[model samples]
Target: MAGEQKRFARFFFYLRNLREAALHTGARAEEAEDRGLELLHSAETEAELKKLEEADSDTLSYVKRGLNRIAFGAVNDAVKLVFDADNMTARDIMGMDLFNVSEIKISGKNVLEIKFFDRQKALEKLGELAPQLDGGGESKRLIESIYGRDGDSL
Candidate 1:
């Protein structure tokens, strides 16, 4: 009775904490809470909780990698190969990395069109994940160096 209540209280506490963390990591509120609940329900012991944490870390890393891939045009090689080939084949199309591609269209005249997921959006998300990559401090230093630290040189 009391023990079960205590366990549930602890569980809710950790679920709220995890939701806050997920929100900080850019998840929507509902999504954060839902995922937190799901993760908490999946874990029974401290060791299981640690394993869940590791799995979450791995998922975040995978998302960051995917964002980098989209932001940096990592799919360009495949796209270029497909474009440069004299004749398009199923194999060539199958080998292309189209994860970043949002849409494809072909007109009656055989003009192929490829639209990609927004690179700028991907970069912004990556920046949110890694704020140090923004280079704000470096930019400030460069500005101060040019303006004698007071902007009075102008």
Candidate 2:
């Protein structure tokens, strides 16, 4: 009906207007951000500007570390998926030629050590193959010791 058509027209008109307004708002926000950066760069003293720059760099580094942690977590999950229990054996992963596995003494017991080769592929394989004798926490800690990082700053 004509009423429905008018309603739809009004809806689209409002949507378009909102979109335009959002675009303008975004532009203004960007301009304001640029001006802020300009003002920061135009600090009263060189030492003050250098301090601000250092703070910005520190923030960027923290962001990078957080991103890296997220990325590493994703990769670790993917590795767990790819290296399931059935894919590898708990004992003798690097049988004779891989040279990526070794025996290490841990708490008076001999345990297999995995070298972090290419995004921890070897470690992932070892984790999959590690015996679940201790409800899996032992194996998880083993892997974490090699790759775990503290991100207190983030």
Candidate 3:
């Protein structure tokens, strides 16, 4: 039982980190890769991450918590459940944060836009997760920023 709880918690943390990273990626295409690295660093165990968020209740919106809770609740006992069953619920998708993020069924691609508070981080995620756009002008700028030509990627 405890293991299940812990897994659920970890799943939520993964969701949070990925969401944060994705949102950051969308927000900062100019410095995409660094933000992607930061997203990697921010990944932590679910319980610790959950506590961290709860501790910062004053900074983030209550709706985020509500969303988190909803997501987490849907994915309890992940270790015991079949892997494909993870996507059967919205909370599962949201809490997991990455499983169906880009592949999410959308009617059109020309007008898809999801904003975030940290643009650079979001940009990094965009580069990492959605690589098709990485060869274009903005991607070139992002690569230049991350590689610094003379600088480096973390």
lDDT of 2 by residue, 1-154 (tens): 3333333233222222222222222324336334333332332323443544455353433433333333232232223423552466545333222311122223344433333324355345434544432345666666667667432333
Give the better candidate number (2 or 3) by lDDT.
3
The numbered model that scores best in TM-score is 1
TM-score versus the correct structure, for each prediction: 0.42, 0.16, 0.19
| Candidate 1 lDDT trough over 10 residues, lowest sum | 1-10
Tens digits of per-residue lDDT, candidate 3, 1-154, equal 3443344344444344433433333535345335444444443434555685665454233433434433332222232223455346766543443321222222374333322234344445444534343234566677788888634663
Task: Tell how far residue 35 is off in model 3, in angstroms.
Answer: 1.3
RMSD to the hidden true structure, all candidates: 14.9, 24.1, 16.1
TM-score of 3: 0.19
Which candidate model has the greater lDDT, 1 or 2? 1
Question: Clash number for model 3?
Answer: 13
List runs of model 2 lying over 4 Å from the truth: 1-30, 44-46, 52-154
Assess candidate 3 and give its lDDT.
Answer: 0.42
The TM-score between candidate 1 and the true structure equals: 0.42
